[model samples]
Target chain A: MLRQLEDRYVHGLINKSVQGFLISNHGNDAWVEIARMANLPPQGFESMLTYPDSMTDKVLDGACTYVGCTRASLMEDIGMFLVTHPDLEAVRRLMRFGGPTFEDFVLSLDEVHDRACLAVPELTLPKISLNDTGVGQYVITTQWQVVGAISLVSGVLRAMADDYGALVVLDVGPHLHSDGRIMETLSVFIAEPEFAAGRSFSLAERLA
Target chain B: MTSTVSLGFDALDGLMPMHILIDKLGVIMHAGPTAVRLRPEHDLLGMRLFDVLTCVRPACDGGFEDFRQVIGQPLKLQFRAAPHTRLRGLLHPLDDGQLLLNLSLGYSVVEAVSDYALTSRDFSHCDPTVEMLFLIEAKSAALSESKKLNARLDEAREAAQTQAETDALTGLHNRRAMDQRLCDMTQSRRRTEFGLMHLDLDFFKQVNDTHGHAAGDHVLLKVASILREETRANDLVARVGGDEFVLIFPDCTDVTLLDTIAARIIARLEEPIPFGSKQCRISASIGTTISSLYSEPDPDRMLSDADTALYQSKNAGRARHTLFKDAFEADDMVAH
Candidate 1:
């Protein structure tokens, strides 16, 4: 999420990801219905632009209603889609740059926002803080304008764990902070570091 | 502790994965595991170091002492292989007068990676090359997405422009489009002779007043199709008013041709159009003028002259065509 001088705005990349997830997982007709329900044009979101925060909220709500799921789950699905979709392999590669292993990636959570900003300067992802509670457990927290930021992070973590052949469980919930800002908390536990043989990753891509 | 410590080959290999050890004769004694992967088909143990790598900077000869002179200085070298991958490295002196050269693929890391099919394991964990590769992929992806956005916006803009220039009810060129075409043809540097015709429906008001606006709309649609059928692909036919249409024919200034076109259009309009169960009857009056008739072609004057001839046809009795020159002469005859 990134805003201009005054008004809060969400980048079109996020909305476009939502649209891509819905259209590819569901169908184009489902996306059309959701867009119509959201009072948006059937053309859907453009990935290089920006829209008002209210419009994003409406689209999320409309998608939740259409998909018969909670908004958090939909956002989580979108996060996984961003990583797993072949069309968005660049996102997966970027997340892989966090570290070599899933545990290293979890430790690099606090730097995710800075790394993303460096990659795409306008995309100001939420800042995350992680606390290593025990040998295989961690507590992650963040305050963002978007309600599903933590849920999306959980989904990305889950997908990355699979990418690295690790097994992890994730739990997410929202709580009110003393400063009156709504903050989300995600609890993570690594069940098995070596769950399965992971997909092989090369530092450089081969041209066909 | 000893004043000078000796390092083992395994320790050096682990510390610098791309390091190469050369003897006093400039022959490679040992290469790090990652360095050996560069020339997998050829063993580097007995090969001349200068034969495999050519020094690109610091102006050095392919000799042992020349390598010794540039030990701590910055070095640029290139592989003498097909891809000619470039390398940056530093050289240090060993206790046995051998050279320990640690190499890194400078900007050619991308090419070398793809050429060698190297993975993250090929470099040390502290290496930033993988992160750089990630940034490159991310930026390119973002750039491609923006390019798509630009293309889509351009398409949307062109569609909006076309919609703005079209008449909603009949899907023909609107008045704005007609005016633009008229101005363009009249003011063009390579002005070509063209015929302008102004036409008005003869009994359209009576049909609208009798059968209601729906029947009028049906008759107008039929009229539009007839006009389209009567025009060439390059000809301009526009709905400029409720009951008026303007047609421009480029390179068509012959009066007889204009008259024939007008007659065919009038005959087509005279046919009854059925809206539901009611047959709506309508006719048309046409006036013609040519750009060659005026000393300097002007859009406003031509339209006004065509309108004057159309009104003359209306007064002379409906469903007839009147040439502007003929109407002007007829007015002269009346004044005399």
Candidate 2:
């Protein structure tokens, strides 16, 4: 089933996908190829920009398949794009205004979405809650009636942590609730930068 | 050339989403259509922002400058609607020199309904996070209830086990518990040295015959208390039979110590026990045996040998203790 998303985010996703594909050495016509693979007409993605809402899953799936990357990776790329995008400066400013620290930014994600809805009334943002499991450990839960795009939220969070230069370990899984809404839980362990660096080296050695 | 879209002030006000407009002085200038619907009775237009609502997060000091500094930042504010509600939003600076307060429910919708006594129909169908929050809350409550039930069950089991091992009349360990203690002691290889003293009260039946059963029970309680006072904390004292008791002393094999203990118990038992309007004197004949003298220790054999010594003590004069091995050696010498 297709998940409906606000047109602004839909346009933003296409632009970022095309740019990301080109940066990764994919051809300039990657957008066209992805559109064709998703069983849409040529240049159909361009029409979604003016519409109030559009089906999001087909575009995301085609982009993932063409780039030979998982949905999570693509979403992460889009999240990073949102932070760095030139035309989305206002959105970037709003996000940076979350707080002075990276943890504060993470905590403000739900409020950020609430503000974003003022400009785009059609936006259906998930509710995000953070539980402090222990020192340097947190469990973030997102409950949404919408079927997809939850991974995009996760990507944004990781990018936010990166913006602060904080090293973290993340694990994501879906918990199905009786109310029929999918609750995505993300377990995060914020590691000391030095310890994270050491762990990366050890992991590399084991892989080798 | 850029064309500016204009609506009349009232038309613009009607089109606005959930918001409140506050002037530079932190006074509410206008309540948007959605905000008015949430709280219709209150006249919020002239009220101070701090008087009408409270800042919940990114805490402010309730000052005008503090409120201004929060512009363009995500915030949580609780509005004093007819029914109170918390809203999450950001402050936007409008061209007309007023701040627009855009609001939406910051928490789970189900919790909002539960806390505010609103119905499901009150909330839009877009978000089900409220339902999910309710599920989580229910699960936590169930887990706490299960833990309490398990604790209660454990307490009841412990109480039942205690009742099974205790003598109802004397509050001492009954014959069954004493047998179990003997088996445990004999089976333990670490406890090579042990002593058992078997005591039988002389003329105990005479007091029961003269007085009622209540007096008999009182006398037994008194004896049990005295035995508990005389024995060490590590020792076990049990009422093994009517007018008969046993004391098990673990990790002790000194004959002299055993004899001293037996003598003390005899002297204590010989004291006058006073019932209502009557006084009775009783003495105890005790038999002592130590485990170290046996080649292979057996609980049953130890008990039987103590009983034999007790029989000798009863036959000798009914007021002293007889050590089984000592009496056996004396008999051998006489036979020689």
Candidate 3:
């Protein structure tokens, strides 16, 4: 995982969750305490682009313990946080330009991840593929995962759909593959008919 | 008889037996009644054995077959019984191609009680492993803290030693440090040839009386800088007294080199140093002594000889260098 991503999540927690909680909530030392709980050296999380995935996982676990939240909930909150965080404004803009409608953006998650890989070359992002099962129903499969934060992807999709004003219903599952790959599949049903129709309309408009 | 045995087994279930039964295909065949009661969130029946428990010892390699190979042997395994609870246990095999995992709490009882909010009655009172873990952790933390403090103390001590040896105003070696250096060099087994030059500022008292002590300090600092600039890299310049300095040149035997250095220092000190508004003029009278010419070269004797030569230069004409050997030859002529 990228330290830039870790830094964003830590800053988000300090500003949002850890605010008014610590007695001496002054500087980065509070975050350093969280890192210490995770069995990392003090001041270990420097401004590097990539770090060991295991260390990041421990740090996230430590953050959850500090905030009195479960791992699943913390991942969801971090995903939601990244959407609106000013430091990640470029990422939000990139997600917006993925497609015109919410369905297009959801379907083009793999492309967005591919672009993300350009920024952090060592990132082992999940491969996302969308298969249209039926009318307004799409099966999104995320495979070849490294870090166990698939819940964060679900939270990000939820926030993205809300941003585009598209109503979406999601059914999430950890469908294990025969090759030992844990594929997180999300069956999304776009409730808004206009948003479903706008996917093709926006694509046509772009083609014109 | 069968009913009586079943009733006895059901009674024993209240004691919380820490064991699990898994099939060769890595599926949980059955869980002990105690294990079930402790880990309610985990549905042990039909769940993947590797998903519920991790093999820590004997090297399971995360493969079902690898884990199956170590079923008969005693092995350590970790079970994800609960979110906060850490379960470690030994694995044994049953006769019917099933594995039995005997479990226990993995962390210190003190930590477990605080973190999981459990009472002391919940744990076995005689388990020394918990106490040992706490002791080891405390010892490790103390060792690391001490190591950090020692590192900081070492840095402070080094800085203090440097400050003690350095002159505050001119940033040159002080008299005490120079004496130590001379002592060390004289006592060395393979003592190389060396030269010492004693320099005293001429008309320095007049400048201090007329221009004030601040101007005199400025002139001394300027003279220190000139002596340092004229000397070689291997040479040492020390402020030994007020308006008095000494230069020690190691591995130097040539008299001409010493003459050149002395002349350069005297010439450089002749230039007027700028005080606040007016300029303070000063000159230096230097005396030279070589260690190679003396039998049993001694630092104290060399210093005394250099001082005598400096007095002769001061008495003759100021702003000149007098060799100790020349003074000795003049004394010999008088005795003849």
Candidate 4:
């Protein structure tokens, strides 16, 4: 389970047959790989674009892609994800000339990362994740998945300069399938931010 | 035999199996086959990757196509995120024993910068770099070819979208488009006395049975074209349904003015479409209604009233226009 200020990222549990998961991290991008063996469907595949970061009310419509899976095993399937590399100058062009492309989105991602790193060099990680399966909309590409206990970087870090406070909650089990698709099953989004204004973060603690 | 976090497979070297490190949420951060040593180069440590990217909306399970577009080289997958340190993994069979995964340690970097921007002569962080320059050049070429295919697809989608709003045979605006047009007409009273003419071609289906669908189509298109040409410039012609057309004239004065226009249309359409041995006789029964500024109501009611009048015209005799207000008493009798 993972939790932050207001945003929460969750993934289904790893199945029993699956031994463990894989983890990867780049610059700030986190890519976690869950390895398992559940006779996956031989023919399975799917993919989509998720606007996890929607601070700008920007949406990529046709840019949203869908792929079908043909052959797969229960544990794994062929999946793909779209990390649009937009052109920033193109966005400025839209703001200036009147039209934009995926380049604008690509550039926007870059801007957000740069801004995060500039504000708090500790948090902003930008890497595309892949699911390699036909299920979940998110293709958990380039994640940093650690199965057992993980030692956190020992540092008294300050609150990152984020317009929206983020948080996450997840449950991992043996009855789960992983192939990068955006998850929309059982989750929660507090609310849309009024522009980039900061919202107070609150959560209920569970006591054993 | 090899050891792993999940499914175990054969070792690259007899001693060590490879490991690929990924984040806690399962995105590949780095991928490569590594030698298995009791003590590895990197160590796995972390609760989960909490970067805002993974905490995105919808939780990207996997629907998007992803590949690192390096400045140069084909878009081949360069890395998988299993674990960055002490890359350790296994090749084990799934519980179903149908498949086996050769795994590795996928590690992470505190932060990564994958996007760059470049400008001419010099480059900015946002501009395409030399590597991206090559990638974009090639990407353009590939996209150009893709555009060709997409164009055909675009046309097909457009055709499908168009078909939903059109008559199958005559290529005229179907009832759906007519409904939209009526809504639009309701918005403005810019033109006084908007007149709706609901017409049903006499014995159109008989023609279809006698001459086949082809001849009926020819006849329908001919009538529709003539109706469009004969009507006032502001009037609209639409195939509201099968063998039924509604001509809407925003300003035609009175029933007499409309009658003259309908008469001219009847005269123009008197000619038969020669289908095989026999000449198919063509005629339309018309029902008209007016939405006057002095007494206004819902546009749908006007169409309903006009449709009733059209039925009366067909009932009395084909090839004529009838006004609903003129026969409202009879309409009341039928309503009861």
Candidate 5:
């Protein structure tokens, strides 16, 4: 992502999420091996710092080699982890605020980047543009500095469809452009709005 | 140009689920759907409006005339029942000679919602209350995440700093840390005094040549333990080189105490350190200087003086201690 920006730096929050996904799912030994493979310090990435974009790429590449998975699958897992992890329930709750139904959430994709900016001013999410072709169909285009974001968006959309009890099929298209800013396309098809009962949500949480 | 649009009771109830309507005689004619749920134990119709709600604001009496005085103005009311839920609204005089009061939970919306087990369906669609709730939840969650991030960042920073200032091989303060401490003590505004020592191993190279680097590491570790054991907790000990160390005792200007400590360290080092089947033997020569010897102690001068005294110990013989002042006096005698 930093290749397109003047600073050429990726925020540590993104790197930390990758680190967290590796450690929690693959264990600390795996994370240690991957960090060592990437020539990172023993303490691994800190969540509040920034690193070179090349370093982020190196870590992701190292993770792919160590975990024995493709880059697209790994990015997708990280996306699902952010939305569905027990420790990150706050993230799921915030997403639920997109609207009452899954279709509302899809239509509100364009505003997701701005809403995220309002929450954390430093965060740089991909700018999403949704093209509604027909009923329950959308051509979602995401523009960002990094290429893997489209795969991640597909993962999030899949999880959110389940969250809203909407059965949907998602197909991730390849990168449309590779220069300047990377852009990718996704096709979404909602099969059933009420496929199953979803988890309940309340406006007022019973905070302990 | 003004027109009046009449709404049916059901339509009014659907629009404002918490409204209250009273006749000219201050009798409760109708209560909105949600208002009826506030006090489900008692029926609302035919009861005096003032009997169920206490007008806590505007100093209104329990009469239609008093209510009319505050018409078109904001009203603050509380349920006369137990748990006295507070409500904020405005009182308006209807054209049919009655009073209409539409109410909503104000700042206490969260607690009121929980207290009543209210859901989104209970409020009108146009109400901003649900949006307010969403914002509150989202901001709190973001605040928590930011705090966790901050905490982890702080931990990482401290760990990095500790690693930077620590010697990886000996687990002792490195030269950088020692230099910082010395600079701090000398540059302090207070009349701070301390005793500094320069100690070098007598035959560490021989041990490495005789055995191997592993044996040499074992001996160094033993020497570090001896130094730590002989010094006080507040004292600073650093490995400035492969076989050279620096020790600083803050607020300690007694040359005799420092000499005793130096002798103890050398004696402990002389004890043979066992490595595999071979016992590695080593000793230490130390030079001491007290900060009180200089008018304004400078780290560079103090270090040089200690080094000069250490060389004196080396010249006199190995495995001994020398004071900078004593070395100077001996030089004076040699000149004579």
Candidate 6:
């Protein structure tokens, strides 16, 4: 879909109008958060979490909205992703490779709503309900008013925390009055995840 | 007792029972354990579960059918049951005979937290999401310090790169760096080459002499900014010296496109930039050079050649572009 959009808009003139086109490159922040969460620093983090420098400048970068909220995960969440994603191949790959990868986790907003039913088990939801969006070179989204299985998500995060040492949660925030449901919630978790940015920047504070 | 299959550990069954729900009475679901003689429990089987166990959110009259699944997919229903009850719901059409529709009340369990909700770094063998911001202040601090250190590293790397090549006042690449790039180009074995150009600000000295060094700095910075805006991402540009700049067209984007780029730049500069109360008009004279990747020409020689071409551009008229090797004879000496 992103490819489709790119193809349609190659002139890139009108679109080039917006600013901040690059990824946040949040790895250093990610490394610090990992160290802080794991109680390690510099070379100390290498044993348990990862070497501080393991998170590089380019790797730290993301095609994201806010740079701060992205990074690192707990072990259990990694396991859950390995179990839950629709693509068994990806799950196997992640299990073999070790990841709380954004592509493996972040979904189209409509997909989030559809997946919510898996978590909640009883919510009737629409398929392909939300539009997938583009950022940098990727597409991610979140939706509102879908019944969520928090416990399942929590379980995934737990497994990830055990397997790795961090947990990650992503949010596009909320959309009010979407099919009459105020769609807002913290939807992602990687077991016990370290914060991406050392100093957390509250989206609420900025918006308010 | 009805023949039942053993479903692993009893402890898991306690928290998350695997029982089928039957619509006998208003009972939504039944217990996992069986009764004596393989018979279903008489007293509990048909009883409404709400009467036996309390619903935390009785008002939570939300439909379970439309829940979100996994990270972002619409959910599918899974049969859920409690350990203590024994009821099942079977929905069937005559053709299919019978379909078991097991239903269980969904709920949240409260585990006695060992520690206060803290930061993720502060959590150990604990649920990652539950540890709120509070009580993890110490870990947060350590995390912040480490983050600061990493940021410092990035800043240092950027600073080093800038120091090696940047023209300080204008924040543009220096002449030395541009020449290095060209030298690499001349030495390369690739057949395709870049178009090189030299630009000199017409009447730049007048701005410095009249408006002060601060004004001069502003104009230079503005020019650099314009060049950045007008050029493609592949292009390389530098402020080689006072009022003189270099532009490298890495790959030839057709001459028409290059002319458009040049024209757009001039048009942008033609707009009077606010220089204090008085607006300053700026324009540039340009010289162009195109060579191949296999061309083993000297970089310094190329710049000199470009400089010679720029002089003709200035001599013929400022705010215009002239090509070297094409516009001027190679033997024509450029005035020092």
lDDT for residue B155 in candidate 3, whole number 0-100: 89
lDDT of 3 by residue, B26-117 (tens): 78766665466455536788888778777777767577878767755756666555454556666665556666666676653344444444
Error of 4 at A102 (Å): 32
What TM-score would you report for chain A in candidate 6? 0.23
Error of 5 at B302 (Å): 3.9
Estimate every model's Cα lDDT from 0 to 1. Answer: 0.86, 0.68, 0.66, 0.41, 0.84, 0.45
The 10-residue segment with the lowest total lDDT in model 1 chain B: B36-45
**Candidate 6 off by > 4 Å:** A1-208, B1-158, B190-192, B253-256, B293-295, B329-336
Order of candidate numbers by TM-score, starting with the best: 1, 5, 3, 2, 4, 6
Can you write out model 5's per-residue Cα lDDT over B97-195, one digit (the tens) per residue?
Answer: 888989989987888887786766678877878667766776665566678878887998999999999988888899999989988898857647999
Candidate order by lDDT, decreasing, is 1, 5, 2, 3, 6, 4
> Which digits, one per residue and each the tens of the lDDT, describe model 6 over residues A63-138?
1123343322221232254444443222222232222333333333234333323322232222323233433122
Docking category of candidate 5 = acceptable
In order, the interface RMSDs are: 2.1, 24.6, 25.5, 18.6, 2.8, 16.2
State the displacement of the C-alpha of residue A104, model 3, in Å, after optimal TM-score superposition: 47
TM-score of each: 0.88, 0.40, 0.45, 0.36, 0.76, 0.34
Best by DockQ: 1
- Alpha-carbon deviation at A57 in model 2, angstroms: 56
lDDT of 1 by residue, A3-71 (tens): 343136677887898889999998999999999988889989988787877788888898899889998
Least accurate 10 contiguous residues by lDDT in model 6 chain B: B108-117
The superposed Cα distance between candidate 3 and the true structure at residue B240, in angstroms, equals 1.0
CAPRI docking class of candidate 4: incorrect
Model 1 ranges off by over 4 Å = A1-7, A24-37, A65-68, A178-181, A206-208, B1-16, B21-24, B56-76, B88-102
Off by over 4 Å in 2: A1-208, B1-128, B189-192, B330-336
| TM-score for chain B of all predictions | 0.86, 0.61, 0.65, 0.51, 0.89, 0.50
DockQ of each: 0.62, 0.01, 0.01, 0.01, 0.32, 0.02
Candidate 5 local lDDT, residue A110:
88
Instruction: Please write out the lDDT profile of model 2 over residues B1-336, one tens digit for every residue.
Output: 977665565764555545788887888887766566566526687888877777878898588777788888889888655456777878887777777787766653444545544432333334343343433443443345456657777998999988888888888888888888888878757545689889999988888898877778888888999999989999988888898998899998888999998998889888889999888778899988999888877888999889988988999999899998976776788799
lDDT of 4 by residue, A120-178 (tens): 23332323222323222122222212111000000000011121322222222221223
